[model samples]
Target: MHTPDPHRHTPVPPVRPTRRAAALALAAATAAVGLVVAAQGGAGAAVQGSLAADTQFYKDPTSQVVKWVAANPGDSRTQVISKRIASQPQGIWFSNYRPDSVTSDVRAVTSAAAQAGQVPVLVAYAIPNRDCGGASAGGAPDLPSYDAWVGKFAAGLGSSRTVVVLEPDSIALTTCLSAQQQNDRFASLARAVTTIHAANPNAKVYLDGGHSTWNSAAEQANRLRGAGVLNADGFFTNVSNFNTTANESSFARNVLNALGNPGNLHAVIDTSRNGNGPAGSAWCDPSGRRIGNYPTAATNDSAVDAFLWIKPPGEADGCAAAAGTFVPDIAYQLAQNAPDPSTPSQPPSSQPPTSQPPTSQPPTSQPPAGNAACSIAYRANSWAGGFTADVTVKNTGSAAISGWTLGWTFPGDQKVTSAWNARVTQSGAAVTATDLGYNGTLAAGASTAFGLQATYGSNNTTPTAFTLNGTACTTS
Candidate 1:
């Protein structure tokens, strides 16, 4: 929780609408033109349609939305904007929480994703006194500690494609801090962004914008400027928080307007679980919500860069479920909240278009710099309690291997314990295994072994199904 010293605070002045209109216009146009995407956009509470064809994978890969969208192409809202954004290389945000060294895990996932051609989105949310006693609490011990932690984080980048969404609510929520504390926080933030950008020139960094409700345009811009938003790749709006796309887009544009940067100040929205919009202004693990649009790279409004699902849908916010824990119930709720698919025989549904092809899988193998070989073996190097196992990798194809990645699905019960050799990334039950700092480049003719130690309450059974380089790997 962010606690402000009441003694040294200056009263907040009222914001003039005249200064905010242009921002609002840009956002309104995005909504009006259906740039809002899926079923969560229309009337009758929530976007009153079915989920986009691709969203069904979010629930049970076999859900109806996936089938409907696959069957009917023209009906879904074209996710062109999302596609455009997903196409761009960006960084993923990594908030400090887990005690285990996730450096390898995060890098493995983001690096593999980059190798496969998609930019991984990362958020770094571990600044001291973060959130200033707001809904999101807990952070690194202090500035020096945070600075060091960020150094490790920068090292983890290791040549992968990514986009970094810097701390969310860090600036806007710092209203209660003393001038010195606020200044210190912003300086640290600037340093973190600068360090990460320096580590990887390909990485795009964005500072956070608290949702539309929290900060006004001028105030946000002022806060962003203070935090060195000028040095960031751009600003991120609505990360792991509540706010409709329309509202956030408008707010972001206004903030940019106040800062006086037009197209250069691009904004990305957290469309992860906002399809039903905010549940009556609630922010903490609110009920009656659905997964927003899946991550994508298309943005119709010129000012907005792209709409992204920064927060992985179904990941809780420290309420009802432990923060960051994947809850099946929450996943189900989000899936239910996804708009139902529209059919020609019935009334129109407002679900957004899904760009992912049917039967598509995340990538596992990456092409080398010059060759087209696909031989990579991925493994789970470690788990929570030191329980580990090693899997053998094979280069099934004749093509010589340069870079390789392995992706798999963990049994519903077990989670990762510890990993080495490569990064380990988890999305729901799906795990995309990759080579870490110790091991990345691979030789086509040879086979490598990697595994993780896992501790489960119950005993295991058969080997889980897996995919390599986005293609299903068949057991020989």
Candidate 2:
């Protein structure tokens, strides 16, 4: 028997940063964002609930909360949230570029998951101009550099089946870029899919589709298609936001339908920090949002692959704390306040509506447009990501117009995808939905109706102003 080395048995001093030893532990864990691969939610003292035999995953002990709970018993938040949310499956954000360790980390996580009969979920968010130079900026300097980084990132997946949530906001948030920049970004994303698949055939890659409250289904579908959805597994929604599962599921289905992918591409929704919905418009670590459903691949929906905790509940979303930093109290609140999925909600869309009448200084209600005075109404059945609208035009004037045309601009990149009951055409956000054969003419004091579908990027506000044949219509 060999004697112990002088350094092998050295005593280490503990660093107690206030009552929350969990905070200290959270500060030191690897894998950014919510790294996936595991059991239901957080596990307490003895790790309750039985594994789903062949349905569930995420057993490798790699969570920050796991370490915090084990290291800090005094911190009750560690046991509270960690038992249910943190100890479960989550996604890993390979945000930093440590090429040397990237391979090992990927192999370690995937290999462990595979050994335990689980599939690991990973996030590759190192695209150039990531987050549009916002709080989480500084991705690869350019496309070539990003490609090289993708190579290293994909190199980590070692044959075992893995689910990869690729590039959050890369597609849904492309309004920041110009036409040429968009082409380049899409090319880079396409390159990422090819690269990941070439490296690991077992890897299922998915591009990001903002959220239900953000992009419209059709617009997001086109964006997803442009970014090469065919090459990858599918697209994901609500990566780090608080949109509800019902809204996300409906929005994602609409997206997949619009894309018309032959292979019925699937989708995944992040059920993290969406319990109590958003606290105001506070997306960055809002106060009251609670943890959502536990991670599960057995999502009954045919189009949905899994309901995952993509963004770990406790981690701050670049606002409340230091961006990705974790706060124990926040974690505890999320866990404690998590809404019971078993309990049916009063309303399906639990989150507060973010849409408002977003328009330019147009005519108010019942404003006069031309000699044929007109009043237009803009109403869209909107969810987080997309919406369909019905516009009713009434000729307040006594003249009966032979034909009519309506024009409007979306507050954001809200583009019309399809139109019916009118001849609709959209260039950028400017829409021109001219009347069809029967509804073209408006008799004196007569009103006609036309409906259209459009998709938006972020803000799904109802168009504030409406123009009838070039004159602004009044809201009143």
Instruction: Pick the lDDT winner.
Output: 2
Per-residue lDDT of candidate 1, residues 227-299 (tens digit) = 8878776787776654456556666767878888744467777665555455433456767665544343334
On the 0 to 100 scale, the lDDT of residue 420 in model 2 is 41
The C-alpha TM-scores of every prediction are 0.53, 0.63
lDDT of 2 by residue, 1-476 (tens): 00000000011112111101101111111111121112222222321112121344453354555556678788756666766555665565666555565666566666666776767677666677777776666567888888888888788788877778787778987767999999999988999999999999878888887776566677788888888988888888887776556657777787888888446378877766554333323466656556655566544456766666666667655556665555677788777744333332222232222211113332223313466578987777775655767678898877887677788888877877544446678887788876644456778899866565566678786777878877878865
lDDT of 1 at 173: 77
